[model samples]
Target: MSRSTYVQRTIRNTIVSEKSFKETLDSFLYELRFFHPVHADKMIEQAMEAKDPKVFDTLAEEASGRFGYLSFGDHKVHRYLNKFNPNRPVLESHAIALGTSPRAYSMTKHNQEATINFPLRITVTQRPNDDRASVTWDLPSSQIPNLHLNKTLANAAFFVDDKFEELIRFCSGTMDEKKYKKILSMDKGAKVGAWKDAGGPTLSKL
Candidate 1:
């Protein structure tokens, strides 16, 4: 469903702390594995073995073309929710499509549960400095069921920005111990609505 409540944020000209351009690119691909395990895992492994960033770039290009079929487009919302509520019924039938152009990616998820479906897109571009990148995130509405369960799922889309920032900090080796531990704790288990509440700043700005 199309609506006006889209989220858009730009992290402007953030410097890449990695030692080299290859390392910077590799770090981005490596962090993506957490959100898109199936497609990114093999590429990550191959890149590690070959010590080549091009391997990851090639795989990323392929994923960008067939974005929907990639692991991220399928049941990713369900997977995220399952981490908090494993007993919920599995999402059996859903249609998620995603595609990416040179510097932008778009995705939409739709299914029986109204809360589980939404539209999100992101774009990251290298800045003139070559050692920095500009990132933008968008979520084109929040029309989900009013139930608590659905609210969490609906809010999950907004977490993409947080995840992206986390990835960048991690790659830069600037993530503090406290923040790292917090991420780990959330990954393990947190109260319902935790994500929604924690993501309020991002949503509020939207």
Candidate 2:
């Protein structure tokens, strides 16, 4: 079967059983593989170490901001994600779709064809309480003919519920200026922003 078909079938079988939660966790891990292996490895470590669901939720919040950490390739049907908390989320509601070009953004620099990795259409919504937001994920029918995916994936928000019990301490908050510069030199994309470029460093928003 095609990879797409396999993804569909795997999702179908997984979501319908007692292991639904576990399946959801696996689905995200599988999708992350399209990106950097380091990300997937780290995520798995987090999941395994998470003492409970609450810990996983915290990790997801942090991971969502570092999507760039995952090594994403040319194209793949990974996932559409939304984090619904009564407060600000790591990811607002958004749609992941197949496209010939990228979307306009300070990130993409309004250049469509420059990067075609995992392009998604993002729409930010604010509820009356103005704290909760819901993001929708769907393939624009006009873009793909008869797109069939487990619609459940759209609602499969917040896969893992807690943080991993085991954690790696490769990154630290303090460093000598020269040491920091050396680390930044490792990843040319290294940038200082909400999301650090490949090797650069950034602080988490509170």
Candidate 3:
């Protein structure tokens, strides 16, 4: 694509994204009390502090043609509705910080053990005309007991971006299974405490 064309597309996307974000934000804030009181402050901070709210085309579900909220931010929890953040380096650093990549939760390895400590939610909707995927990360929940927002973003980014990138690469018939399995088996660190022990991936960086 030409530079002019790319710029035009970007400008158009921004216009659409900003409008959708405002619509979603008002709805999210209105229902904040049901989710948690903490989000009231967080939502306001998110709206004002981040001048350009991040855009995540991945989590932005579409209907007919235009993207809009279907239910509960339309599969986007809070900031992630259209927020494309936790870029590549931040995703990697946060994964290391949390010590838990999304790969850590292998059902076969655990013999189907069910737990909710580190949740990496994944929803795949096959697109007949698309081959690419988008990625982003958000805090686990504003109400989780001890883990703060930054730590949660780090942990979630693994699943959202880093690990999903690998999954996409592998499924695209580019990567060999042997290499992918090796990547999966390696332990990075424990998710909850790695933040306490050795923390450096800052929120600004994320």
Candidate 4:
């Protein structure tokens, strides 16, 4: 069963206190850096350093990216995307897909074509009403092509959701970052399971 390359979730917060809001944004940047992304910093710096008027939205947008953050209107968005299709997003309504490479995630033993950088976007919206806010997990693209071939992309997205449940901890006020589960252990375990049936030519000599 083929799955759409898109996934999105919106979590509404009833009590978006000023302090909690600030902490959320700070934690967001912290989480992005925690993975040691390769391309986000330069893009963030250029956005910070742009002196002249950034007139057009396009010129305003690339100030470079794929694994970077940007702000517009009520939303603050950051994405690590590859193979972007500019026709307009089919799932998430946010349009922050500035084109470039996708090398945000760390390399894994399972996705060793060096091609498994997850194509994801995080959109935090402070709604028109100051009291309401939402965090949307927008998966506008996936790291794997099985998105349209089978339901693997959807399955992978589900796995990611499970690993990162603590992301919304600001809503509850106790974000024990240390308790967050290891994100790629499932992938490693899946690889090991496949190894049990290792074929004729690829068995390890060791």
Alpha carbon deviation, residue 203, candidate 1 (Å) = 14
CA lDDT, every prediction?
Answer: 0.40, 0.27, 0.27, 0.33
C-alpha-based local distance difference test score of model 1: 0.40
Clashing pairs in 1: none
The reply for model 3, stretches above 4 Å from the true place, is 1-121, 124-160, 173-206
* Residue 3 lDDT in candidate 4: 53
Q: Which 10 consecutive residues of model 3 have the lowest summed lDDT?
A: 7-16
The alpha-carbon deviation from the true structure for residue 203 of candidate 3, after best TM-score superposition, in angstroms, is 15
Lowest summed lDDT window (length 10), candidate 2: 160-169
lDDT of 4 by residue, 94-148 (tens): 2221222222122222334324333334554444444334454533233443444
Q: Which candidate leads the pack in TM-score?
A: 4
Per-residue CA lDDT of model 3 for 135-188, tens digit only, reads 222333221333233454334333233332333333332345676455446454
Q: Per-residue lDDT for 16-133 in model 2, tens only?
A: 1112323322333333333333343455567678755445444433443212223223221122222334354343222222211111122233223223322433222223333433
Q: What TM-score does prediction 3 earn?
A: 0.20
Runs of candidate 1 exceeding 4 Å displacement? 1-20, 34-124, 139-154, 158-161, 172-174, 177-206
